[model samples]
Target: MTALMKQNIRRITTVLVSSAMSAFATVQTVGNFSVLSMNTAGLPDFLQGNDVPGDKTENHRMIGAKFVEYGYDIINVQELEFKLNLGQDFNYHAALYSTASLPYRTPTSGGVPFGSGLNTLSRYSFTDTTRVKWNDCSNFGGADCLTPKGFTLVRVLLSSSPEGYAYVDVYNIHADAGVTNADLVARASNLRQLSEYIDNWSAGNAVIIAGDTNSRYTRVRDEIRILTRENGMTDPWVELIRDGVDPTEETICANPTTLSYCETVDKMFYRSSPVLNLQAIGWSYESSRFLQPNGDILSDHNPIVATFSWSLPASLRQSELYGGPHDTWFSDTGVLSRIFSPRISTIRFRGGSRLDAVSVAHVDGTSITHGGTGGRASELKLTDGETWTEAKLCLGQRNNRTGVFAIKARTSAGRTLTAGSSTEDCAEFVAPGGWGIVGFVGGSGSEIDKLGFLFAPH
Candidate 1:
């Protein structure tokens, strides 16, 4: 009787797991409405004195138009002080702050306020906005005393409609640049405060807190760990990448194409609320493409974009278990399993296109679907009449490479499995500069397995 009871439990668990897999096959298909988040490449140069051809207002208009073209609903702007005519041209509602004039300090090189750092602009009507003041406990009586800058928080309500009010809170931080250790600690503290504030204000509402949180060193990474583990906010960009959506872009760099050492400093964080369903998050060089034949690095930082669907389950905010220090793949497999991780894992797709008609096959069966190309935005799913098995996956792309597709599965024994690009390549969607697929196989295998392929361009 005990053995029979155990068998029944095992069967139930298997059915539940299979149902979840089927649901995975249907990801990103929900109610249509969505909201997106992005960092405003950087403030326009009239603010920075880069000596381009236009006045501050004109320059802002040009850049503002470019930002709008990217379809960003909310934008966080760093170095707001550098832009001479900062807010004159942009039509969106905005808030700006800086620490430049904080007591006991010489003006910043760019002449923006110190401590008074990050700012934000938005297309949707913001119900209210406020800045969290910095602590001035440090008093270096010297002629050039270094005063600490306070982190700034901007609260924007998405709507005033009686629909119970859902809002995304934006917390922007520009920590100390050169000093590695101290900078991370300070930034972490600021992030904790921001997270606490959001948690306090909206409790269970959808919350998105983003900015340039510089977490590189071991110390900073530790703080980030605290943020994720304790605060329950997920880094959608990182999570999506783990799910096979390479949304990273070369944002902070000494020069274009030649990336600097400190990449991924800028990031977006999402609260795990059922209301805040992160659909796709990515970065864009769309504005950079418009740069005149002349050379200018748009803004020093890259713009990170996150798309959210209102109906996605809260589970979407839970980071998936893959490709990390303590990931599920770690204990289960070794060696070759390591190669299964993406070699050149993160690359921001510049062109915004769509990948159409892609397919995926599990050990049990197969299915198909589609998504945008370029950034970590590609889509594929089960076709029909086929349940997924252990190792088989087939995907085809139609729109050049507008999207990205990744693979995840479980063996019959219930061991979780993860891997890199699928064998199926998009021979069909191959266009001049379009969308397509990068496939992966599920089970323990050696050698490329071609499920199928598709191609398209926009």
Candidate 2:
């Protein structure tokens, strides 16, 4: 550690750090998108015209015009089925589909007695679309079994970041209608089936579930809680409009246009993933936008809309982030660390049997630290030309909560640093080809709750 050597190190660190910061500024991803969920009430022309004002064919044209005007990024509509025998030329489904402005859309799952009546329109491209019919249906009060009422799932390509293409699993569902005991039982089964489907198909992915649930938070028999309780989804109406409070009983909206007092069955839910972070920034009931010339309502149920802002790490590439969902998320990019050419200079850890804290210092002299300060402290310093090439983490119960229990870092020069207790549930992350681990991302609080690596070229 001579004076001239220290001066040279500082100069090199400054140049590398500055370059990393500049690169990060160009790759950061942040943007806002909007979604609309509506039940178009696209029943048979005779049945639909009797229930809602105006002709079914004309109403569909009006609804589609509004959808185009609103410019929603994603649109979920239920009861949009068409039956050829019921007058193909005058079908409401065809009228609505023809006027939609969104460039991308899901084709009708089926016709009348067979279709799920669920469709999704989006501004972005989507793939892997699938529709599942509910196993349970109620014939006591509503003819729910006459049609294949169920849900549709689509993986939408939201945007592209340095990490990869950001994708979200969007679900649109229409549950059994009515409030009879048999109907309640059927709706409960519908929600449970959807919960299981999400767990099985959309695991570890960001998701947005919305449509005519035909269930309410205040209704005890709705069982709408299963989506949140079982799958960790957030209801934007409850979170943003209701102030995170569930009304004890059905709330009568004095003015539905305000969107503050209404608890419509048409609802929306969302959940974020380790790769993408989603936050509901705005919500509206959309009462005025869908009105006719004389101010007639569009359908039996008003359209509900939600606006979300998303963000992801600005790294060249990232390993799968691991941990529980109970802490604040952080990324090395927030601290101006470069994810392309930076190298890890030092890694410090504090823990005994469970990792309590982690601190990483880069070649640029900028360091990012996370977690608490309760465990013993240890540090690993890499010499010139040495860099971390692999990381192993054990994720398990710590203080009854899921978190990082152990960590091991191995360098290109063969030096190793280890901490905490290794367990059966362990995951290893290795840099590919000429890449090396240079930074970190994940959730952390009093202890290191989550852990993931960011890679850069040597």
Per-residue error (Å), model 2, residue 240: 1.1
Task: Look at candidate 2 and tell me the lDDT of residue 155.
Answer: 75
TM-score of each candidate? 0.44, 0.66
lDDT against the true structure, per candidate, is 0.38, 0.80
Superposed by TM-score, candidate 1 places the C-alpha of residue 277 at a distance from the truth, in angstroms, of 3.8
Per-residue CA lDDT of candidate 2, range 1-458, in tens? 99999999999999998778657634555678999998987887554453577777788899998889878899999988656574345456778988987899998766667777889999998866788989999988777998889999987878743343466889999999899999999999999999998876665568999899989887888999999899999999889877998778777653226556667788899998755689999988887788778877768777889999987643345566677655766666434333336777898888887888888898777777888897888899999988888889998885678999889989998888888888899988877546677767667888888777766667
lDDT: worst 10-residue window of model 1: 324-333
Kindly list the per-residue Cα lDDT of model 1 for residues 234-297, writing each as its tens digit: 7665666445333333334333333313345566666634324444444332334334336664
lDDT score of residue 121 within candidate 2: 93
Error of 2 at 91 (Å): 2.8
What are the RMSD figures for all models against the true structure?
21.7, 12.1
> TM-score for model 1?
0.44
